[model samples]
Every structure is written in structure tokens, then in C-alpha cells.
Target: MAAALAAAAAAAAHHHRLSSSSPAARTRVVHHHHRRRRSSSLSFSAPASSHGCPRGARALRRAAAGDGGGNGSGGVSTGTVDPAAASSPSSSLEELYRSCATWTWRGMRVNYLVRGEGPPLLLVHGFGASVGHWRRNIGVLSESYTVYAIDLLGFGASDKPPGFSYTMETWAELILDFLDEVVRRPTVLVGNSVGSLACVIAAADSSRDLVRGLVLLNCSGGMNNKAIVDDWRIKLLLPLLWLIDFLLKQRRIASALFERVKDRSNLKDILLSVYGNKDAVDDELVEIIRGPADGEGALDAFVSTVTGPPGPSPIALMPAVAARSPVLVLWGDRDPFTPIDGPVGRYFSALPSELPNVTLHMLEGVGHCPHDDRPDLVHAKLLPWLDTLPSTTALTPVSSPAA
Candidate 1:
């Protein structure tokens, strides 16, 4: 159900030619650069959840015993996957899963984990996803940098209270707070899909120096609304979105829908739809995603996120964010929702022209979440770019330019 709803959100923004006074946006040929877009909320601060592994390191380690226990928080090992066959040769899947941790924020548990050292790097998952989503990249990136992967509030082990708004601003605030209170450093944020939008907002935040850099993978164009700009995609999907948005809001109905989609078979099918690499959509991956849906607040959070307002698009957030920080924009050219040939793609293609500091890479034949679908390809491009950036010690001064 979550995947279905998320797909709708992406569809609405597929045809957008951003309402940019920028010359590039104005001249963007219709259907030439497809860009698809696809967020949450609440208030009050909970006591600082221990920045340390919340589930406790020992409990997480025990998850390696088998998938029978339901205790793991945010790593793929939170379920079970053949450690031998994972993408990273250096670390087993079970070891990665053992890193799962939990933090309390605003009266709810937020699941996350940390690994390695050096400058802090945080991974934010997209809609219906958790830290486990980044299993492939975390182990490799952690070799040189402290890699933190978290299940956003209402997803994974995070507490999902009823009545949360589930908007972009909501998640952005949480990201900022997590940086200040947990990682306790100005850090680079790497996000996929909706998570990318949250990182954009966090980097632009006026209140904190939490984000030092950003990497957006197959970034969503909008939050939860239809196309923000004038486009046929909006006209085409508005009615369908209206229906899904309505159906998702009902409690019993939402739960029923969740049950159907959470089925292992249904889950695999949905994953295959978005993941371009057919081989990667294995049973373990499906179980990892399905595992979180049964947890508390999962259904409610899904409904809220699905029916929620569309947050600012990259067009809306990029100018200010790019001025303050360097951004690496990655797009899977084969993304069905936001084809590289669609409006979203055009917007990204035009980015380098507007912000010379921005680096954009188009991955051929990949889908919505390139980081997960092709970790090797993503890392091949990512690590080199990361090396070029100044050290964390050098980054703070750039963010503030101390007098």
C-alpha cells in the first residue's frame, strides 16, 4: 500500500516544468527531461534518546542467530539475509544488522545506527523505508567515514504516534535534531527518494549548522502533492491520487490495505516495480521491508505520508541550499515515475548551468533508488567525489565563514 501510494505521488510530478524564472526552466522542452517527485510531522521534544545504540549492541548482535526473533531495528539483518552474498565483501550482512540502534525524539523511538569514523555521514531512507534500506552502501562508506543510517520517525522502529502531520518540514526538523543531538556534528547527508527532499530542507535550515553536504539519489520532485508546476502529469493522475489519498486515511481500511501489500509476494512485486535490477529484489530484501510494516504506527504513518501535502521541490530548495553547500545530484535514467527524459530530468540537467558548484550524474538504466539497486556503481562514483571535499574540520568554517 505504501509503495502504491508513493508511486502516485511520484507520478503527479512526472511532467513538471518547474515554475522557474530561471531561463533554463523556461526553455525546458516538454517531455524532454522527465523528473518525478514524491513526505511528515509533529512537535515537542522527547528526552534525548541515548545517542548510543538504543536497542543495545548485544541485543542487535543476537539478531544474527536467526529471523525468528523480531527485535532488530534498522539494518537489513533486522530480518535475515545471506551475509555471504551481500554487496560489501569486507563486512557480513549480520554484522551490519547488529549496528541497529534506537533514539528517542519527541516522545517516540527513532531507530538508527552508526559505524566507522572520520567525518559523519548520515543516510536517510525514502517513503516506506528504514535504515536497512542502505545496507549495501553503509558498510563500504563506513570504511572512511562515520556512516549513520536511520529509520525516520514512524518507520522502522521509530514511534509513530497518531495525528502526526508527516510533512517535509517535520522530517527535516528531525534530521537537524538528530545531527545536533546524536552525531553532534555538521555532517554530510545522503538521501534517496523522499529522503532526499528532507535532506535538502535540513541543509537549508536557518536554525542549525547540521548539514555540511548533500547527495540526492533519484530525488523526488515534490513531497506528497501533485505536480507543483503546470504539467499534463498532474491532470492525468489527480483523480487517482484523490482516491488513494482518501482510501489511505481510513483506519480499518488502511490496515487492510497494508496487510495485502505487506504480504511477501505482494512486497516483492512492488519492489521489482521500482528496482531496475531484477536480481536485487530477493526474498530477504522483501522481508526486510515487510518487517517494519507490522510494527506500531506503521500503518498510520503510511496514511499520513500518503495523503500529506507536497513539500518544496528541488527547484524550490536548491538555489539557497546550493549556495551554502556543494550538492551531488544522482538520477537513475530508467526511473519510470520520473524518467530522465521527463521534466524532473530537465530540471536536474539545467542545475549545473544555474549552480556551477552542483555536480550531477545520470546513471543509465537504473530506477528510483539507485543507491540500493546498484551500490557498486553508486560507490564507484560517490567515493571519488567525497574525497575531493575538504575535511569536516575545513567544512565548518565554509558553512559559517568565520570573521
Candidate 2:
């Protein structure tokens, strides 16, 4: 049977890791401050399938989505913000991104949303996405657990300080620091794409084990573009990446390109192409992504992130984090940016068998933004896993401080 073969393959991979001190086992990631390293050889483009912005990746996504058509598979809605205004959907959506609270991080105001009052849950969004991306799940998830969704400083209502360095390690540091200063309790980190990678890095490198569990939704290969440089796709995308990087350096061109990509029409098309469930691409979703572009340093952040260094890969960070906290991976098989068949996806697909702490569920017919594309499915698996994690109150070290 196919399942038998998969089990055999997983067993062989696990055996290989056991044979030698696995690269994953030996890899010890430290704070980005000390170990801040970037990929120099290849100016690889970020995965085309992520949320939006960073011109090159968006273009690639359009091409990929064109080649790969979407399906009508959508999750049933669990609940809406306001059922009374169901016919006029926008009215219900308006109630989603309101009542936000702010927290100071490094002298800048970082926007966040907090709700229910049980165990804490920190939601981190992918590149070009903000807390509004979780509009559907926030209300539902909050009913059982205290949910906190942050804008990650550079995106959403958070401070977009121009010329500021944006890297996965920096975001990871922000998450860890947020846990220490803000949450101040053991919390579950639920992240998507680059957000997931940031959580992995934070959980792996932090001095304290403030994270109780991890829910990774299609974790990305690297922060920016550079990841596994040897992948055939990266080799093919080299010239395009170079060209885009060059164009982004020019202020006028960068601004013009940013303008085009952030347009509501373009965003809808991009979202449609990547999402298996096309109905989920509502006007509010487009506004959530588009509204941030008008910010003071938004354009600069876009260019810098697209051209910036690709931080540490999750492949190298997961081993340490998994050894400490339970990990639940929910991947949308239809993702184009980090396709389920790609290097990052394949690595995670095999992880659950290799490590007992990991659990992966390939959401059938889902796309890159699994959380939003099919909240019903993501919640079905996520909510149960979260309930199973043992509650913790103290700050214990996640990994050995000495890298």
C-alpha cells in the first residue's frame, strides 16, 4: 500500500539521522545578534507563493498560479463575527480588525489584539500579512484560549521604521522578547510561512522556554529569498531575482512597482491564484493587505525585505525546538511559494515520523494560506492539538544557552 511505502521511507530517513550525529542534531542556533549571517552567493527570491509584496515573488506567483489552476474546495464557516449582518458580509468583516491594543517594542508602537482569558496563544502572520489575516479564526479561537495576534513591527499597524534591518532573527528576537516582557507566561506560538520560521528560530534560540507548543502553518524555507540555493527552482529564478533586486534599489521604480502590486485588483488575483478556496478572497482581506502599504516606510520595508539577507532556515532550527516543545504542522498541499512537494515541505512531511514530538497534517485541497483558506480544517486539527498540551506558567530554558 502507499501508506506502507511512506512509512518505510520515513523509517529509512529516521535511521539515517540516527546513524550520524545528524546535522539537525548538531546544529545549535544562537541569538541573531551574535549569529546574524546572510546568504552571499545566491540572491535567491522568496517563495512566490507567500501572501504578497516583494515584487519578484509576486510576479513568480502569478506565473505559477496561472500554470496551476485553483479548485473550489473550501472549508465550512465555523462562525461569523456578526450573524445579523450576514447578507451584507462587509458589515460583519468590519467588526474583525477593530479594538486593537498597542505594546511598545524597542521604542516603537507594535499593534496587537487580545481576547479570551485562558491559556495564551500568540499568532504570527507571514510576510506582507498582518493580524487582520486571522479575522476568521480570531473570534472562534478566542472563545476557548486567550489569543494574541501581533503585526510583527514592520507590517500592519506596527512601526515601519524606514531603513531598519528586517531579518528572521530580528523577528525571532521580537517574539522571544514579547514573550518575556508582554505575555510573561508560557504561550503557544502559531505562525505561517516566514512567521512560522521566526517562531522556530525563537523557540530554538531563546534563553527561556516561554513557548509551550508550536502550530506551524506551511513554514517557509528562509526569511527572505535565500534558502536551499541548490534547488533547481532557485537556479532557474536566479536571473529574475537579480533583475528584481536591481530594480528595487531604484526608489522611483520600487515605489511604482509597490503601487502596482498593492492594488486591490492585483491582490485579489494573487490571492485567488494561491487560494484553493476562491470564495475566501473577500474585499476586507484585500484591504487588510492593502491598507499597510500606505504607511510611511512601507515601501522601504518591502524593498529591503525582498533584497535583504535570507536568515536561518527552519530545516536547521527545528531539531532543537522539537526536542523541547511539541510541534504541530498543518500544510496546505496546494501552496505554490513553498509547495508541498518542495524541499521545505518535504522535510517537514518526513519530520513527524523522525521525531515523535512533531505532527503534520496535509490539509486536503488547501492552498498556501491554510489558516484563512480553510479555517474549519485548520481549527479541526489545531484546536484538538492545543488542548492536549500541558499548561505551564514558568520561564524555563528551551535550549542550552551556549550555542
Candidate 3:
């Protein structure tokens, strides 16, 4: 009876020890499996550290291995890791915001935005427009090239140095200076409306060798003599109309002038769309439009360009550019400023037919600034053409030239 009692007590004690060991061992295996899954999910290749063991198991193992450093603490302390250091590339793009810089050129502070990365692409906005006009194309173009959109002198964020003559030649020189100093490279010069004229002049000048190609969008340089004569009549009336425009600049007068057309809705929408976001079309932008209306010098810049001497006359320069560089002319068929069927078309048609480097594309249902209205269409046509051009077209060691 004494022996039997002893054996029963031993069996009970062994069963108790087995029950406790099995649960702990099973918990440790589950814990290790969970850690492995987490590591795999994070793509972490780090070796499993001693801490990879279950909370109490690591301490138990350490104690069993005679390592006195590990106390009987049930909790496991893991070192902290930086989350930012493990962040993805998309997070870097989210941190990017549009930035601007001012550089001195011909004693004028010209403001420009340099965004994205790749080959250089210089964008010039037209009259009554700021760099804001290029908002639609900026992101798309930035994908393949570093896009620099600038506010021409006296426009947008640029310092309008009071009394500075805003002639096309002067503007052209300013752009050339900008190209030399800010866009140090042979850049693809893309210009719209009056800006196109400036780009043409710059390209015509032998000094602007950095201009690799020309993309003129709904250009105004090809103005016919009859249009010039008609515009002169309006300029003669500017002195009398000046007072009315000044008083009505902020009021409905500016909007009324544009609203007189049959396509008022489209025109109004286009004007508002240039702001990109409606919030940007605040009192400040309204003031920019009114500045030229109130100032006599600004009025002269507009009048002189249309009726005065410095207006865009492509006859002299177009022939020269046609001989040298690849000139891609894009005209909006429905352009109100420079109609395809009007004097502008006649001027372009008069160009030598056999010119090998010149190409003309007529965009349907687009207006004065196709880059703003139909950027995807413009980009679709542009990218393919650019691909065909020699890879050496981009200037080497790209840097802005001295103004």
C-alpha cells in the first residue's frame, strides 16, 4: 500500500509537469510563427534576434542557458525604429510644392518657377497672362523634362519696373537674358500668342544658340497689314477710350468687353479657367488685368505692339528661323485673336513652301492658348516630334547664362 501510494503521487506530479510544459511550448511556437509572418509582410530580411522568442520564453531560455543577464521579467522590450526612415518614394512627391525664384535681368526682377526633372523646357506665357497659364501643362511636361514657367516682365509675380517699355524686342531681349541666366542650356522654347513672337525673335538672334527648337502656339506675329491698319484705328481711339477703361477697369467694363461676343460663355469660362483654381482669381488677379488699363505706359505697350513700331512682324525673322532650326507652328483654328483664315494664315502661307524644317499643325476647336485649353493634344503632338529630333539637341552642362 505504501509503494502504490508513492507511485500514484509520482504519476500525478509527472502529469502536472507535462500539462504545464505543453501549453508553454505551444505558445512559444505560435509566437514564433506570428513574428515570422510579420517580418515577411514587411519584407524585413533581418535575422531573428533573441527577442523573437515569446515574452516569458526568452527569459526562461536565458535562465536555463545560465545567462544571469536576463531577469525573470515577463515583458520583452523591443528597440524603437524610425518610421520616416522607412517611408516610400511616393511620400517624397507628396512633400513637394510649387516654388518660385527671382533673378535680376536687365535691372528687372523676373520671377520663374522651376519644377520637375529631366531635359530643359522653357515656357513663355502671352500678353494678359502670367506663368499661371502653364499650370495645366506643368505636371504633364515635368514628367519628361524640367519645366521652367516664367512670368514675363510686368506680369504675374515679376516686378513690373515702372516705366519699363514693354516692347516685343525689349521683351525678346529679356527672354534671351532669362534663357542665358536662368535656363542655362539649349532649351525647347514654347511660347503662346505674343510670347510666340518673342520666342521667334530670340531664336532669330544668333546669340540665342541655346534655343534648340521653337513651338509657337496660336502665334500673333503673322498679323496681316490690313489687321495692322485696322488696329491702328483702335490705337488712335485709345486716348479717348483710356478714361472710360480706367474708371471701369474694376467694374463690369472689362467683363463686358469680353462678353460682347456670341461665344460669351466659352470665353468667360476660358478666362476664369486660366486661374486653374477659382480661389486664385481673387482681387489680386483682377488688379493685374486692370494695371495695363490704368497706366498710360502699359496702354502704349499694347497700342504700340498693335499699331506702333515694335509690334511682331514675322516676315523678317520667320524666313531666318525656317533656314536654321526646326520650327513647329501650332495654330488654333478657332482663335479669335489670330484667325486661321485671316491675315495670320496669309502670312504663314506666304512662307517658302519647300522649307524642310518647318511644320504647321492646325488644332481644331481650340482657341488662342491651346496649351491651356488642350494641353494633352499639344503634348501628344510634341512628344513624338521631340523623340525624332537628335538626342544632342539638349544643351550640355545645363546652366543659366549671364544676363
Per-residue lDDT over 1-403 for candidate 1, one digit per residue giving the tens place of the 0 to 100 score: 2435555333433432334212311111112111211111222232222122222233333332333222111112111333234334333445555656666665556777787766788999988887777877766677567788888877876777655667787788788777766676778899988899889988887455667788888777766546434456656767777777776565545555556667787678778888766766776678668887887666667777778877777777789999888788877776766666666677877787788768877766567888777665566556655665666553242222111
Clashes of 3: 4
- For candidate 3, write residues 1-403 as lDDT tens digits: 1111112222333333332322211111111111111010011122211111111223333322232221121111111222222111111111122356666654446667676665677899887566666755665566556777777766665655432445666677766666665666677789987788788887887454678788888777432122233454435644534343342232232223222211334334445543222333333334434443343233223322333244557766788887777877766666655666655555664443556676666655556667655554465456655544554454454443333
Clashing pairs in 2: 49-337, 209-396
Could you tell me how far off, in angstroms, the CA of residue 140 lies in candidate 1 after the best superposition?
Answer: 0.6
Error of 2 at 370 (Å): 0.6
Ranked by lDDT, top first: 2, 1, 3
lDDT of 2 by residue, 57-83 (tens): 334333322322211112222333232
Please list the residue runs of candidate 3 whose C-alpha ends up more than 4 Å from where it truly belongs after superposition: 1-98, 222-227, 230-308, 349-352, 393-403
Number of the top lDDT candidate? 2
lDDT of 3 at 298: 35
The per-candidate count of clashes, in order, stands at: 20, 2, 4
Candidate 2 global lDDT = 0.68
